[model samples]
Target: MEVDELDFLASSTLYRRKDFLETDEAAKSHPNRNYYYRKNADVDRLIEACTTKLKNNNDNTRALFIRASSYVKKGQLEEAIADYSKLLLVTPDDIDALYQRGTTYEKVGNVDSAIADFTTVLQLNPNHVKAAYARGACQNLKGDFIEAIEDYTVALERDSQRSVSSPKFHARKKDLQSAQAYGGNTSGVPQDAAKDNLGTVERGMSGLSLERQDSMLGQAGSSAAELRDSNGHFAAGSSAAEPRDITGTSASAPGASDPQGAEFYHARGFAHRKRNDYRAAIQDYTRAIELDPKHFKALFNRGFSHDKIGEYELAIKDYTQSLEVDPRNGYAFYNRGITHDRKGDYHKAVDDFSRAIEIDPKNADFYHNRGFSHRKKGNFSLAVSDYTTAIQLNPSHCRAYYNRAFSYDRMQKYHEAVADYTKALEIEPDNATAFHNRGSLYERIGRLQEALSDFGKAIELDPRSALSFNARGLLLERLGRIDEAASDFNRALSLEPNSATFLRNRGLCHRNRGSYQEAVRDFGQVLAQSPKDFATLSNRGYAHRKLGNYSEAIHDYGMAINLSPDSVRLYNNRGYCHAKLGRYADAIGDYSKVLELDPNNIHAHHNRGISSDKMGEFERAIKDFTAVLKLDPYNANAYFNRGSAYDSLGDFDKAILDYTRALDLDMAQGGDGSSQNAKQM
Candidate 1:
C-alpha cells in the first residue's frame, strides 16, 4: 500500500529588533526599528525603507538583513540571495547571514550553494548545531545518506552537550538514526520528496500501509514564506538563542528555554515519522505535547504514528485529542477514520469519513477510503457510489477506479467491472495487479483470447507475479494447450512453491496429458498440506484408477466420500475401482449407492449390471440392464448385455431377438461391428 504523509507546517523565522541593536551602532540609532518589529507591517514598505537606508549608507548591514528577509517573505528568492551576498561583503564572517543565505539558496533549489553556505558556517563555528542540522538536511536531499548521518550525529552530539534530555537532542538523535536506516540509499524515501526543493528538511517516510495514501509529509499547502521559514531557526529573542533543558525551565536555572519550544519538537517528530521510525517519532510528539498540551500538530502526528504501529485505540485517542485542539481539521478526522478501518470498525470509519467530508468536501481520499470501508462491510453499492464520487473528484485517482471495479465484480456486474479496470489501467498502465484482476474478469466472462492476452501482459509487467502465471496456466489448460500450461504452472510453483492452487492446476494438467504417476505426486503434495481436501483426494483417486491401482483408487475414493457423503461421482469412481479388482459384490454395492443418490445415472446402472452378471445373478443382471436401456434407449451395449443374461437363463429366442435388435441399432448409428461386440462396464 502506498501512503501519503500530511504536510507539517512549521512556524516562520522572524528577526527581532534586538538582533540589529546588539550587532551594529548604526542599527541602535535607527528610528525605524520599532516599525520593523510591528506585526502585519506592510512588507513592501519595509523593503522601501531598507532601500532608502542603503542609499544613504550602502554598507548598512541592518538594511541588508531587513531587505533580504523582506525579499524572502515576498517570494523573491533571487533578490533575497543578492541582499544576503551584500551583507556577506560587509561582514564576511557573519554566521547568521551565512546560515540565512544558505536557507535562501535551498528555497531556490540551489542545493549545492546551500550546502556550501552551511559548510562555511560550520567551518566558522564548529559548535553551530543549527548549521550542522541544516547541512545534514541538504545532504539528505542530495542523496548523500552517509554524509547526512555524520552531520546529524554532529548536531546530536553538540545538542546533547548543551542539554542531554532536550527535545532538540532527541530530534537530532532520531534524525541520525533515520539517516543510518537509509543505509546510504534512498529506496524508502518517496521520489517526489527528493525532487521537491521546498521540503528539503521534511522528507516523508515511506512504507506506510495502503490506508495512508496521500498521508506522507509534504510541502503542498505551504506558501514560499512558510517554506523559507521552515528552513531557518525560530524567531530571534525566542527560546532558540538560549537552549532549554527537559524541565522547560530557563537556561540560567537548571533548565533553559528551548529555541523553537514545542514547535521544534513537532518538526522533529515529522522528520522521525518521515524516516518510518514511528516509536521514535511518538516520543518526540509526546514531548511536544508535554511542552504545549494544545499543540494540535503534535497530537495529530502522534496519532498518525500510533496508527502506523497498529495501536488503533491509541491512534483514535490522539486524533480525538488533536480534533479537540482544532475542531475543524479534516485531516484529523480522515486519519481517525483510517484507524477505525484498521480496527475493522466500518461504522465508525464511515462516520469519521463523513465528518471529514463535511469539513472539506473536495478531498478525494476521504471518499476513496470511505468506499473501501463500505466494500469491507459488504455494501457493494455504497462502495461503488463512494468510489465513483472519488473518481469524479480526482479524474486521475487510479485506486478509486480499481477499487470500484472490485465492487462491480462482487456485484457480478462483469461489464462494469471490466470498464472500470480498463480506466484504471489507462491511469496506471504499469499496474500489474490491475492487469491480473482484469484478466481474471475476462476469464470469468469467457473472453478467452482477451484473458490470455491480459494475463501475458501482467506477467510481462511483473515477472515475479505467481498469480498471473497460475491464472494463465489455468486458461491455457482450458484451451487444451497442455504443454504451455504445464510450463506456466511450473513457473508459478517455482515462485510460490507451496501454493495449493498452483499444485492442483499442474496436477490436473499432468492427468490430462496421461502422466498419471506425476499427477498422483502433485496431488499427494497438495493433500500433505491439506489432508482433508476433497478435490485433491477425488483427483488422486482418478489418477490411481488410471494406473490400475484399483485398491489404492478405492481407498482414495472412500476418503473423498467420507468428506463429501452425497458425492455421486465419488461413489461411481469407487465402483469402477471395485469392478477392476474383481470385487463384484462390492462393486454392485457402490454402484447401488450411486443409483440411490442419482437414480437416472446410466453409468451406475450399466456397471451394476456387469457386476451382477459377474456374480452369476442372471435375473438381477437382466433387470439392471433393462434399467440402463430405460434411461438410454439407444444403448447398444445394454441390449447385448441383457441378451447375454437371457441366454444364461436359457431364453434363447428372446436372447437372439435382443442381439439382432442391438446389431440393427448399432448399424443405424454408423457404428462398426467391433463397437457392437464390445461390452463396456
Candidate 2:
C-alpha cells in the first residue's frame, strides 16, 4: 500500500488513494504491516467508533480522514461515500475528504459534483496533479475541450516530474480527430498512419479516467472520423471519402447482388432514419430489399420509418415483406404491432404483440405494450399479468408499475394502485407525471401528507411541467392553502400559455382562492379555446353566480344547454340559475327537461316540485315530492316540501302527518329527537 504498490490500484482512478495513503501512513507511524490484514468487520467497527467520536467532539474532520479508504479500495463505494459525506459535513474544507469524494463522485456519475470537489481541492493545493488531471478528464468527456486543455496544461506546468502528456495527449488528439470528422473533414493520412495512431488512441482511453461515458472509447469513439446524415448519405463533402469496396470486402454472393453492398444500404437507411429523413431512408432500405429481397433489417427499418412518418399502409407493406422473408423476426413483429396500435386496430395489435412476446419472452417492452393493448380492450386481469411479467424481467421498469397502477385504480384496488405507484416513483424520482398520478391516488386514500410530498417533489423536479403544477394546486386548495394554490395555478398557466384544460383548472383554483376577476379571465380563455365545452361553460356559470352576476350566470347556463341539450347536469344547473332570477316557469321547464333525460332522478323531481309550487301548482308539486319520498324515504327536504304542498292544498291532517315524517328523518340524521314534526321534516 506504499506509493510504489499504489500503482496496482492507480490504473486510472485516484479515488482509491485515500486507502493507499492510509495504509502507508499507518505502516510508517505504527511500524506494523500486520494490522492491514485485520478482519473486515473489525475494521468497520473501528471506523464506526471513530465516526461517533468525530460527531460528538466536533473533532478534526481531516485527521485520519482516509480511514474509510480500505472499504473504498475493496470497491465498496456506498460505504466510502457515507463516511466521506459524514466527514465532509463536519469539515467542509478537508483536503483528503474532497479528493476521495471527488473520485467517488465521478465513479457514481456525479461528474458535476466531482468537478466541483476536485476544483476545491486544487484551490487548497494547486499542485495536486491527480485532481487536476481528473477534473480535466471529466471536462473532456463532457465536451468542454478548452477547459480540459487549460486544466491539463496547468497540471503539466505544476509538476514536470509527472507526465500528463503521454496518455492525456492521445485523448486530446482523438478529440481533435473527432471534431474534424464531424465537420466533414478527415485526417487524410495514409491508411497505415490512421491504423498506427488507432492503437495509441484506443490504448490511451483505457489509461484515462472516464466518469459518465464509461463505454465511450471502445466502440463509440473508434468511429470518430465516420460521418453520415440521417438519409444514410455520407456527410455533405465526405461522400467520396470512403475506400472503394474490394472483392474481399465481405462474403461474396454467387448471385449478381452484393451482400455487403445490401448491408450498407440497410445501415445507411437506419442512419437516415436517425436524421429524420424518412423518405430518403425508406428509399435506401428499399434498395437493400431489391438487392436482397430477404433482407429483414432493411424491410424492418423501412416499415419503422414509414410508421414514424404516419404512413401506416406503407409500414404494413414493409412489415409484411419482413415477415415473409423472416417470419420469426420479433423486432419486425413488435414494430408491426406498434403500427396496428397507432391505427386503432386493437385486435391486430394484440395479435402482433403476442407473437413478438412468444418469439422473445425476455423482451420487457413486448409484455408492457401487450399489457397496454389488453388494458385498452378492458381486459384488466390480462393486463395485470403482462405488466407483472414485465416487472419481473425488469424490476426497475417504472412504466410497467405506472400502467399496472392504472389497472388497479380502474378495478378499485386503491391500496394496490398506491403500492405500484410508490415503486414507480422510487425508480424514477424525476418523473413528474408519475408523481402527479401517485399524488391523486394518495388523495383518494386520504393520505394527504404523502400525496403533498410527492406533488412537491414533482414540482421541484419540473417547474415547467403544467400537469404537476395543476395537481399540486388542487391539493393546496383542498388543504386551505388558497394563496399557494392560486400561485401554483398561475405557474401552470404561465408554463402551458394557452391550454384550455390548464385555463379551466386554474379558473377553479382562482375561484376557490376568492380571486373572482382572475377566475373569470381563466374561464374566458377556456371559452376561447373550446366555446361549446359544456363543463367549462357550466362551471364558469357557477363562478358567475358566486360573484352576484345573475344575468351573466344565466347566459352561461343557456349557452351550456345549447351545446349539450341532453346533459341533465347542465339542465339542473341552468334551472338553479333561473330559480335564482325569479323565473319560476323557466326553472320548472329545465328541471322537467332533466326529468325527461333521467326519469327516476330524485333531485330533479324535488327541484321541479319546488319550482312548480313557486308557480302556484301545488297539486303538481305534491305529486313530484311524493314521488321523491317514495324513491328516498329518508329525504328531509322532500318531506318538508310535500308537507307544505299538502297544507297549500287545504289538507291539514295530511300536512301534519308529512311534517311529522320530515321531523323524524331530520332527527335520525342528527342523532337527536325533538318535536316529532320538526324531527321528521
Cα lDDT over the full model 2: 0.63
Q: How many clashing pairs does model 1 include?
A: 15
lDDT of 2 by residue, 442-547 (tens): 8768888888887788678767666667667777778898888778778877887886766776787777767777788888888897788676788788888778
Q: Hey, what RMSD does candidate 2 come out at? A: 21.7
Model 1 agreement with the true structure over 462-484: per-residue lDDT tens digits: 89877678778878888889899
Compute each candidate's TM-score over C-alphas: 0.75, 0.50
Candidate 1 has its poorest 10 consecutive residues by lDDT at: 236-245
TM-score of candidate 2 versus the correct structure, residues matched by position: 0.50
Judged by TM-score, which candidate is best?
1
Global local distance difference test of model 1: 0.70
